[model samples]
Target: MNPFELEAAVKAAADGDASAFAQLIEAERTQMLRVAGYYVRNHIDAEDAVQEAICRAFTALPTLREPKYFRTWLTRIVINTSMSLLERSRKTIPTGGAEAEYLTASHKDTDGTLDLLQAVSALPPKVRRVILLKYMHDLRLKDIAELLELPLGTVKTYQNKGLNLLRTYYREEIEERRRAVEPIAADSAAWEGKDMESELSEMLHRSRERAKTLFENQSAVASAELKPFIEDVFRHGDQVRELLFIWTKPGTEIGISVTLSPDGDLIDYSVDMELYTEQEKCLHLPPEELFAIGERFVRDHYPDAPDQFSALEIEDRGDRVFFSCSQYASGMPLPRSGFWIDLHRSGFVTAFKYFGSKPEPVMPDHILTPEELLEEVAKDLSMKLYFMRLHESVHSQGDDRLHLVYMPQPYLINRPAVPESGESKKNAQAKDDYDPCAGANEPILEVLRRNEPGVPADPETLLESLGISEAEYEVLREVDMGSERGVVYRRREAVPAAEAVDSTDPYTLYRYMQARNEETVKVRFDRDSGRISSFIDFREETGILQLDDRACLEIALNLLHTADPFVFPHLRLNLEEEEDKETEQPSRQNAGFNFSVCKDSVPGFSHHVSVSVNRTTGRINHYMSADLGMEELEKLSLVPSLPLEEAKRRLIAALEPRLIWELDYSDDRSGDGHYMLRYKLVERESGLSVRMIEAHTGQIVTDNF
Candidate 1:
């Protein structure tokens, strides 16, 4: 299927279309099993591992943010699942295989492909993963890094090691066969028929089912594969178990630490739960200190108490603190007006927040002096940040920082909890019994012989071969329903561009928003420097805009169907017009970019936002909430860990009279940003919002007109 169809199928699966998902999975299971068997040497274990991975992938289906990475994501999950299975295994499996059509026409040629497959199947699990990825898929080092979430250097290392092992193994195997048939060696010309590369490729592409079938039929199957499964599954399980525990249990082992400025002042503090391992050994703060420390910490140490103070989950170890804040929820949106703090163990803090100004009905129990906030979270940040800096020292220069992140095995400090006593003894007994991860120094050739498949294509060529339908492709176009067209068509040379003036509401409240409506929001943001320099968009609209005594709420959704929003060769947007809305001028101009904007208003609360557009995708790349001051921030104790919907509800309660406008400036390089219009609704009050346009273009530097 083409990308669009795949995306739609993914979306359907996310929405609970079990059948569609099953079909997609069934179509790819053959490949999935091959890959799984390569990473996991035991055929039975490999089968079990792939099934488990598929189930997890299906359950967490919605978490997939990008459809294009589907295969890669699935590959990672399968690898992870196999590793997990290995960890939990007590005894390792001994061998594996992939299917081959043993029939050759006229029985004339003994398939060389089988020989090639045998060599690959012989390599170690780790080395095999690299080989299959490199040869079977022919992906570059960097792409493999993204797929596996491993470093490019590490991938390269595996590639080199695996190839060298294969070369050494293939030579030894050839010699053994030659010794038995000395005539072939004497007539070396006849033996030139053994093609090592072809055989290896076939092995990498071998079917897992075939490998399994071979193992079941064999008299003695090795047990090494099971050992790896035991090792990996338990290791993986432990990490997952810890995260869930931290998320569900409160104050199980809370601890915090702080780094004092030589001047003994606070710079930044973070709240984390991975610090203190033993709650019993953790520092226990005397009650009196909690109340008393408030004065000096906020009033004297951070005179900017109301401003610079930060409060988060802090491991309250009497003197040696640990980390975290009850970010589960904020009570209110504190006006950027006053200072508020809280003092409590995790459960209290997690259920409610205060740094973003939460409720402090009872000062002693809930609220703390500004000083208390600083004392709590700084310790946690210091520890986590210190480790981060150390890692940075090692890999900081590897790549550009503007769009990529380089984090090594996210800061792991809390020692993994020992499995309960009984399970530990049981696992020990199991460990003494099996050896599955290693199937011997299995000749790379024999392993490959078991799994190799028939037809093969290069990475790019294969995707083309799957080919999706054109009709489905059309539904994938990028759309912008927010065009301020009245000014363009009615007032310009051709037709009326704007929808009939929003009789109910129109206009933007933020002064900066005028830039979106006027097509003059010049934005210059440098990723490396982290700066928003300028943004602009201008449009002339001829319609009655009745916006007063009200606020507006508008949302514009740009449906994207292509990887390159511009020059999208396969798709186009379809817009349905409403009779109630004003007649619009149909033109070749805004046909590609379709926009949708909605507006409404409320009473007493003041809020407004404006967005800009600069590319064919015409999507709002970022949004700066209009009134995100400390007062409101402090009340956002509910913001930290809430689902997006819960966060929105809390925001609505806290920031009532607010306006947020968003526009898409996908590419400044193409002044084509000009023809794109993002729609919007400006609200002045609780129930008041004006429908309008925030067309932004011509603010970017592009090589072409």
Candidate 2:
């Protein structure tokens, strides 16, 4: 929507027009939900938060000081609501009505994914929120910090600490499995009691029982450091019970570990594949069936599997074909194999390899995961399974590097209460000075026995309770409407401008800014030929003000300021999808805009289309080309024959960032050699139309016009 449409919508909503408000809501709901979902992992809960946030915004619209910031304001509400819901089930906002209204398809998917979400939901509020924002919602850390009103450093600290714990936990699990295998061969005499097949069966039974017991008695057996990861990791272990217990044929646990960047990149990860058996197990898979099962498993579970992970090497070693599946992805905590019809065996899984950036410099394991070492040193800090680690550049922080740990509250709505005796004493602690309602008639405190229970009643309530009829209340409310009557304006007349300026009146004095000299050039809109623009203007012939540009700007700003914020907010966004094996990052080309005002009239949204000094940029950019109007060629340049590119070149000037230059020939040069300059080029590229911008003036220096 353009500024005028936005202004109109805001004005209508401010006047209680709910339909106008809907457009604003529709435009922002997706962004609100995305941010809200991160806070409230529970789909239904997030939906509830958005609804309530919108509803609250509707009523609060009247109080907004800046409507242009509606987007950010609503986001703040959504973020706060998510945190409130996560930390305490008791909602921060009354959203009961909104929850039912905003339900969508995603809200229903929450049920089946509960098994997977177990680990995620177990995280503390702060940690879990960070993870949700980073992965689930794919928000940048900088935005997360701004939305949550937190310092950037603090958010980064939480992210690093959280992911480190998760990585260490998975790594430790692998180490334990390795130790259980004990690389040294088992004693031959240990199988003295029975034949190899029968002995293997007995060992399988024991191993299954042990694994089941660990799964069942984990609440007690798991160490505190790994307990949170364990609970969520296996929270829905029962949901996948058959797969975990019944289809049991494990060598080593298949686990995955993910490393995330502050910018939402899946920077690194490892998938570990292990082959081991309990104290004993049967290797009786006829070579034919085993290979079939392994191949089927890889194909079914990893349909999006990496291409050519490893060359399959099959060698017929007389007794059996050694099928070697090599160099699979390591550090994946999630198992790779799922049930495949061809595999016939649900438990059969094959090793896979990892892709993406090679890990940074061959730092020692401890360097990569210093938080683990810290845990080893400080036994008490165990909350570290929900964050991504990103190194801080020295320019950002003075530290060598910082970790972002997601620290969410593990539970919600459990708070300590005050004692009964202290409750009575609360009234005694009430503030003393400036009680406008002090001993006022009607004792109106009873109406708000909730918000301000022990406090004095408000004056409005006091008057209403004093038998002031509805008719009488309006007069009282309007008594001091125009301005505070306690001062000279008490006579109920418009004060003259002289007194308005001299007086520290209830309203701020108006200061008219000097009007800039009239400047004009032809401007054109390719599509919306009839839309009015928001700009300052002056009549060329009369040399008189055609319109007060400042007043026009103030009107738009005021409408934004007064309009319901939940319905509209200022929003600026930059988002791009990640590069994966199948796809690469695409370069974005930015095309510059050109405009010169025309005498021709244009249609508008609600008002007249006038070509003025408006400088608003276009909405989303689309690739296209257009012929420059003859007038555009002239207004921007008196050289009629000169092409657009050459004309632009003469208009541009170059400059460097943060650099100061002192010309020896300058008569007005200061003693200090300093004048900072910044640069930008106007013409943009969209992979085809190449152009260079004049660094200093941000004008189109050159382009393939």
| Native-to-model Cα distance after best TM-score fit, residue 57 in candidate 1, in Å | 8.1
Candidate 1: list runs displaced more than 4 Å: 1-705
Candidate 2 lDDT over 73-179, as tens digits, reads 56656655555444333211122221211122122223334543565565556766765665465454544564455544346545543443333333444344335
Residue 645 of candidate 1: its Cα lDDT?
35
1-705: candidate 1 lDDT, tens digit per residue: 323335555655543344346545644554455545544443434555776677657644544555544654575567556545543331222111111111011111122224655767876665677677655654434445545655443465465455545545545454444344443332332233234224423432242223233223322212212110000110121011000001111222122212122222332221222332345224445545643444333454345543433353233433332222221213322222133333333211111112223233211233333233223212211100000011111121212111111111211111111222354323222211111111222222232345333322332232122121232212211212111001110112222212222322211111112212222111222233222211122222223332211111111111111111221111111122232112222210111122111111110011112232222222332221121122332232221232333322322222112212111112222111111111111122333221111111101110010
What Cα-based lDDT does every candidate model obtain? 0.29, 0.30
Candidate 2 deviant stretches above 4 angstroms = 2-4, 90-459, 462-705
TM-scores of all candidate predictions against the true structure: 0.17, 0.19
Q: Name the lDDT value of residue 190 in candidate 2.
A: 29
